[model samples]
Target chain A: MIENEFYSQQNVGPYEYYQVGEFELEEGGVIPQLQLAYRTYGTLNEQKTNAILVPTWFSGTSKNYESYIGPGRALDENEYFIIVVNQIGNGVSTSPHNSGSPIAMEAFPHIRIGDDVRAQYVLVTEKFGITELALVVGGSMGAQQTYEWAVRYPDMVKRAAPIAGTAKNTVHDFLFTQTLIDAITSDPGFKGGRYTSHTEVADGLGRHADIWAVMGLSTEFYQQELWRLFGVESVEQFTQGFLRPLFQSLDPNSLLTMAWKWQRGDVSRHTDGDLAAALNRITAKVFVMPIDEDMFFPVRDCAREQALIPNSELKVIESRLGHFGLFGAEDSYFEQVDCYLRELLASP
Target chain B: MIENEFYSQQNVGPYEYYQVGEFELEEGGVIPQLQLAYRTYGTLNEQKTNAILVPTWFSGTSKNYESYIGPGRALDENEYFIIVVNQIGNGVSTSPHNSGSPIAMEAFPHIRIGDDVRAQYVLVTEKFGITELALVVGGSMGAQQTYEWAVRYPDMVKRAAPIAGTAKNTVHDFLFTQTLIDAITSDPGFKGGRYTSHTEVADGLGRHADIWAVMGLSTEFYQQELWRLFGVESVEQFTQGFLRPLFQSLDPNSLLTMAWKWQRGDVSRHTDGDLAAALNRITAKVFVMPIDEDMFFPVRDCAREQALIPNSELKVIESRLGHFGLFGAEDSYFEQVDCYLRELLASP
Candidate 1:
């Protein structure tokens, strides 16, 4: 059986959980308690002026992005109050896989990215009473969530930083996410949502990683040292040796739920009015940073976003370090990012 | 009935029916007349001065690389003579599925990268009747042929340009290719290769495309365009669109043959001594341009190769474009390539 874990510490931050109300998804009328798992780092000032909200990327928890939360990083503990919210479907949050009888495909709710943001909004505003905030920083799917936060509640967020992300589901990300979902939902062991723990889409996940890997690195990276790094001989050893460990780390349920959120990630879709007008309405100071080699979010995407946000600038991370380059590379990326964030904070 | 046609265009160029001799696959015994299907764009001038070998890439043809041959691009037809040779199993050359009887996998001939070069050696020496090649250029699978020519027949190939490709299959490429083969061959519709054209592996092909699309483009590309590209409003529309084309493309016989050939693409396999030592024996001006954003042939892959080759220099094709960028956005790419080829041709 797949194990579901939640964390709550004295001041552990994103590990904190708040029971938001029971919300029903649009597709199936399955009602489940939408308990939000979140974390906060850097204390909120009395005026709540130093708050910066951080949403997650696809298949991510608050934990994955925790490195950027400490002092000297983007969301410095000394400067601003930071909050990292986990979207539903991640094991720490409410997901279909962990529920009782409401787990079948037909029975589970078709939760969208907007729905995820809405749920998180309740946790942020109602429970934490986060009123006027600072920045909404995220990458990949996190970028999607951050965008939603700005568009959904323009008065709340003052700045937006989306890294290695897109405002909408591009054809490439859509296909990859769709394929991954297909891999999980169609897992023979899944028994059409009945099975929870049996190798539910291990091949699919492995395939997903393979597909995802293409955008993560350069051709030079693969040809040169893949076999050597994995310490395997031949293609078979390399494929299995690494993928086996990767498969072990990812839970199938988390993959599926996060995919559902990602597939539905469109801030424009959530808005009733014109997309351009809605985009124009965003008053947040936008800093769109897409890795030069990030396949997930290309420079073209960043260019488009920068064009939309009037008070925005584009920073392309041109390193051989692919998509994950935004996180940390040869320390140069880190230093550049550190400088950029500090300048942004110290600017006005 | 997938309308299978064999085109014989002798009048297009100075052509002759060259019996490709025989191919003894290690999976089985010898098959007579292992014919090669190829085309040449430019004439091989006297003294074989202008000859530049253009080998084929994966899922490519004499037609695919023709764009690079014509004017202004790398291996420009205006300046250098281009020979686009088709590898075995590419329908026209040596193949398994096309073979009348079953060739057992064990005895299938070891058609290594060197073997492909040896076959080209026959095409160049016996058929075209030429010796010194000014340059050997290719991308992806073609790069392997170029590497083989540089190392195996160093005297013939004075310069080499291998782009967006790896020296050998990495775990990623190997798995991707293996998955492609598995999708086609393992389908129940495949019917153990006995079901002649009745059942096609549509799911497999769709799955292959799903896997391939990830490798081909950035996630942003998929996100911004997958729905329209797939021509679907809903998930079902998208699903059917991908599966149909992929399943339809699998000419069972060609797939198996190509898989076999691809598996045997290692150049050092045919060398007398250690592979690295064999590679070091090359005496050519080597230029390996491994794509920086390429997932399959990681930039490091080319770096390792450059380290191995005695006189090799590596150029990273820095672009958000994935593997296909080497072909599509050849703007940033071809200029450097053209200059290199011009310099190579300018040499003694």
Candidate 2:
């Protein structure tokens, strides 16, 4: 039972767990026993074929995906059983902070995007006995897992929408991810991931969030004074009150684990570095959506990967919100997304 | 007297000093005794009209300006008395690191680009007895001071080239600058600017450099593996060996001082936020050169500010080198700049 307010399911709920025993990672690491936390809205139809899978992004929980989960939304849970699966190392799931002594903290071997996909596959096939997915969708790191599911188990996924993330981590993305990890571990208080209190690295966490403030969002986000839209008086207030405090409150080791996985995200890893061949493995009717203003995963980068997937369509979300556009920042963007997703889900 | 290798002229030199006594800052802080470090190549003509002023960029020294200075370069010191003035907070100058007690470290007063320009004005007019400048040129934060010189003392600056920087810090630039400052201070070892050794904040410094690895240059730097041009096997090698070590060696407080100045760089502040009014104040033949691929100073953003300057010509340096193109990364870019400078300076 995780007691940490920051990690507990009680804080951001509708969360449940599925036990996937003796999970083995693609990187040759093993978790003796594992539990994957997830949240579901709506009910599984008698066919069980109407279930849609939604995965969380870096530092994002199930609630982050619920922005469009309403009667008439893109992820209208009323129409389908939508399961928001929490990625491993995202605190709510089995993470470095809450795992047992043998597999806790530094002992928590590196997890990869493939490992998360594999775990989710097991939960869906064994626990829910769902043989096919109506749709699999996510953004950012969630998009990474979405790509993994499509390529790794193409037969199980009929449709896929990987938004604002690439099939392979670019050299730039790797560098960005490295910077975040280094920021956390560089803290003297980190103690090689054995720190007594997570807050000891609060400054490092705050710095990590500060980076997101610059790159995670678009230049127009600040220029348009969108901070005021979020009910903040100034950029300083938005940064200090929201961004910094949110990251600073999380477990540093958990963040590191997620970053490590984020860096090694390469769908081509199993296909001998041939990204095209890996992408060709996808049988899913794919909707490759990327935000135009995203600094990390620019539309140019995503478009290249989308072109490689034989059964894919590229949809660009035009917004000044950058990567955060996936968070439903603008109603027009959401409307565009809802229209596209509706067509994607309804298609044969 | 400053023996710290990081702050000492011995490490990066060919520098001299012009003592500008009791310098008063635009922010109302006064340095009891201010010494502006500078390096001069070539000779001041009998006419005292061939002097060129070049201010250093953030974390740069006089030596950085030497890259484009030689017999037949854009900044050919042979034709002009090129004075590379070290921005005040850069370690060699009267920075937080080398400044005397009471006003040292955290106590060092906030600095602005205008203050640096003011000090340079004193060095040019009072110390060297130079009445006018042949040119004033620099990139990044160096460009900031160039803009300040043109706007603040228009008659003294006959010609100016502010490359890869803006007349005013954009909202994105301010956010980026704030991240760098917060990244350093968030280190618990910072001790609120009273650290025993600079390396105590090495992690922060390294993270700071890592940021530049992303925004400082173009995406092509990674895509084309241009790091090979710098003789590094991988981008990681360039970052770990060169970038990180370079910044980690510098004094944290000194970096903070420069960053503080960089963020507050706005020529319009004196013109009551009328950027066009401030640009109109420049009588100098201005060449506002921004790199095509520069992320921080995009061509679009720079073009807007360039259009506002009444007597300005916008020369966009088209190169895949991004902001670093100003550092002579591409020969074609340098040729364009050299051709433009030759034309600008030779005009009767």
TM-score of chain B of each: 0.82, 0.96
Among the numbered candidates, top lDDT falls to: 2
Residues B105-154 of candidate 1 have per-residue lDDT tens digits of: 22234455655777788888888778888888888878878887887788
Q: Candidate 1 lDDT, tens digit per residue, A132-205?
A: 77778877788888788788888888888777777766656666667667655544565665556535556556
Candidate 2 per-residue lDDT over residues B143-169, each given as its tens digit: 999999999988788899998899999
Q: iRMS of candidate 2, one decimal?
A: 1.6
Model 1 lDDT, residue B248, Cα: 54
The TM-score values for the models, in the order shown, are 0.77, 0.94
Candidate 1 Cα deviation (angstroms), residue B323: 4.9
Name model 2 segments beyond 4 Å from true.
Answer: A7-10, A43-47, A346-348, B6-11, B102-107, B195-197, B346-348
Error of 1 at A235 (Å): 10
Give all candidate RMSDs, comma-separated. 5.8, 2.5
Interface RMSD of each: 3.8, 1.6
Model 1 docking tier (incorrect/acceptable/medium/high): acceptable
Q: Name the best candidate (by DockQ).
A: 2
